[model samples]
Target chain A: MREINVAAITSCVRQMCMDANYHLSPDMQARLFEAAETEQSPLGRQILEKLKENLEIAAADQIPICQDTGMAVVFVEVGQEVHLTGGDVSSAIQEGVRRGYQDGYLRKSIVRDPLTRVNTGDNTPAVIHYTIVPGEQVRITVAPKGFGSENKSRLFMLVPADGVDGVKKAVLQTVREAGPNACPPMAVGVGIGGNFEKCACLAKQALLIPTDQQSEDPQIRKLEQELLAEINKTGIGPAGLGGTVTALALHVKTYPTHIAGLPVAVNICCHVNRHETMVL
Target chain B: MDCRISTPFTKEKAAELHIGDMVYLTGTIYTARDAAHKRMMEAIRQGRPLPFDLHNSIIYYMGPTPARDGRPIGSAGPTTAGRMDAYAPTLLDLGETGMIGKGRRNEAVRQAVIRNGAVYFAAIGGAGALLSKAITSAEVVAYEDLGTEAVRKLTVQEFPVIVVMDSKGNDLYEIAASKYCTE
Candidate 1:
């Protein structure tokens, strides 16, 4: 069994937090550049230009791409064959989040309560999702979820009879209703099937896919393509100025569900979808 | 549509802007988000004077990340406007000329925009790092206890924003988005 030091995990998590905020993944950047090329609307193209410029500036300056530095959300893939030493893994992760937010100058956007909504000064106690895998390596991914696009996320429960067409319609409706609120030329992640919680998790997990890649299943790929086209036709344009390309990409993830229910969830991420992963 | 607004804006200057016009924001603007806005509104309700002169000023809905070395502010981008919709009318009535943020506003806020002669401008929602370049300086003005949510006075240069809703009751987002939204 491989032994991983808790201190190492803490350090890695802190670095991941800062790195995710400052850098736009190269795959995402490439897609945005490609979208700029094919975007028909002049306004949409202009928005893409500004977006690219923003990414460059953020990277060079070592600052967050957006003001809402986001709540720390960490996805951990721990190996069953690995034993953690030195400190508690959960506490270490939280400590990393606190340090990263303070040292990296990222914003502390998390609030203590939903109703009273008191601000948590250090953006501590990150929302962590863990999966134990059969390996000796541990992997961590940190995504700073901003409120703008997060506010537009939606989940729908459909009758199994509704099928693929229903899924398409639902995804389109979510983007349509979102309008400029989610920010235009958005990347959409669709989760089909699974239980309620699983479907929501799948939607967020789908966002982890590279922006340029298409779904492996031809049927899902076709659905993704169709949805992408339809959403752009909405002309919500860049910044909702009226444009041809309103959505940059449509990504879908699915799992089997109960006979009676077809669950669908849409997780919308803005142009600055910031995330990074590390293996140790 | 061609419209012009002067520096140290007035209620009348805000009245001329229509939805869809590209706006070049000059002069000083203040920043505040959930915490500060609530406090300011509470103060106003208690008949207390605001920390700064809100008359003819634009309030950017933002909670910027902390600054890195040699920088005035960190990735300083706009937050959702709707979150502040509940408290916006009060500021508008107090003579706010414009609002800078992204997303939709409630109907009441839209009406207030028209009635109060203020315009709502949409800044690129997540383009904070790039947007920070336009901010020359930033200093907290009030509600320091709230940390990042404190009210801040920001001096900006050529800050770019698009008018989403104007004083005349036009909404760019509604108009532009409706064209492509099929039932």
Candidate 2:
């Protein structure tokens, strides 16, 4: 069995948090360039140009791409063959988050309460998710979620008979209602056929997929394409100033649900979809 | 499209802007978001003088990240405008001329923009790093206790923005969305 030192994990998490905030993934950059080429509105094209320039500036200056550095979210995949040493894993993760926010100059955005809202001085106590897998190394993925798009996320429960059409309608409606608030050409993650909470989880997980990649399943792939078309038709455009391409991509992930109910959830991510991963 | 280059905007200067025109802003502006706005408004309600003059000033709805070494600010970009809609008309009535943010505003804010001769501009929401380059200097003006939410005075040069709502009732969001939002 392999032993994973808690101190090492903490250091790794800190680095990942800082790096993700400071840099935009290459895949996302390429996709934005592609979107700029295909965009029909001149204003949309201008917005894309500015977005690309922003990414370059962030990378060169080692600063966050957006002011809303977002709340810290850590996803971990632990191998059964590994044992943790040195410190408590959860505490270590939080310590890493605190250090990263402080050292990297990223904004501390988390608040202590949702209602009566008080700002939590330090952006600490990260939201962590863990999954056990068969391996010797642990993998961590960090995605900073901003409030603008997070507030627009929605979940719907439909009769089994409604099927895929129902899912498409719900997604389109969410995009339409989101209008310019979520930031367009956006990335959409749809979770289908799961329980209420699970559907939301799956929807967020689907966001990790690369912007240009297509689903392997033909049926779901078709749905992704159709949803993309319908959403852009809303003409929310870039920065909601109006354009032909409102959504850059639609991602769907599905799991078997209760035989009687079909639950659908849509998670909207702005063009800044900041995420990064590391294995240790 | 009409283009205007303006600096250190005055109320009279801002009144000249129209909806859908592109403007490049230069000189000093201030940054504030929900938290700072609330505090500033509260101070106003209490009949206390504000830390900075609201007359003829443009407020950018943003809470920028802390600056790294050798930098003025971190990825500083616009946040959603609707959230600040609740407090904006009050400032407009107080003689604020220009506002920079993202997303759409409510009807009341839109009407106020028209009635008060104020203009609302939209900056690319997530393009914080690129936007920061335009900021030559930044320092806290008030509410330093609020951390990133503190009111900051920023000097900018050739900062790019599109006028989404001008001194008229025109709204780019409604116009653009309606074209493609076919039932």
Cα-based lDDT for every prediction: 0.85, 0.86
Give the per-residue lDDT digits (tens) of candidate 1, residues A136-241: 9999999888778888999999998898889988998898778788877788889998999999999988888888788889999999888888887787877777
- Native-vs-model 1 lDDT? 0.85
Tens digits of per-residue lDDT for model 1, B64-178: 8887778788888888889899999889988887889998899989898878878899998778999999898999889887878888899888888888888886888777866
Which residue pairs of candidate 1 clash? none
Q: Evaluate residue B64 in candidate 1 and report its C-alpha lDDT on the 0 to 100 scale.
A: 85
Poorly placed runs, candidate 2 (over 4 Å)? B5-8, B179-183
Clashing pairs in 2: none
Please provide, for model 2 over B35-154, each residue's C-alpha lDDT reduced to its tens digit, 9 standing for 90 to 100: 989988899999998878888889999898988778788888899989999999999889788899988899999888888888899888888899899898999989998888899999
Q: DockQ winner among the candidates?
A: 2
Residue A18, candidate 1: alpha-carbon lDDT? 90
Error of 2 at A46 (Å): 1.3
Question: Can you write out model 2's per-residue Cα lDDT over A1-280, one digit (the tens) per residue?
Answer: 9998998888988887888887778777787888899888887899898888888888888888888888888899999999999989999998888888888888999888878767787798789999999989999898888878887889999888997888888998898878788877788899998799989989998888988789999999999988888887787888888888788777999999999999999999888787889888
**Which 10 residues in a row give candidate 2 chain A its minimum summed lDDT?**
A116-125
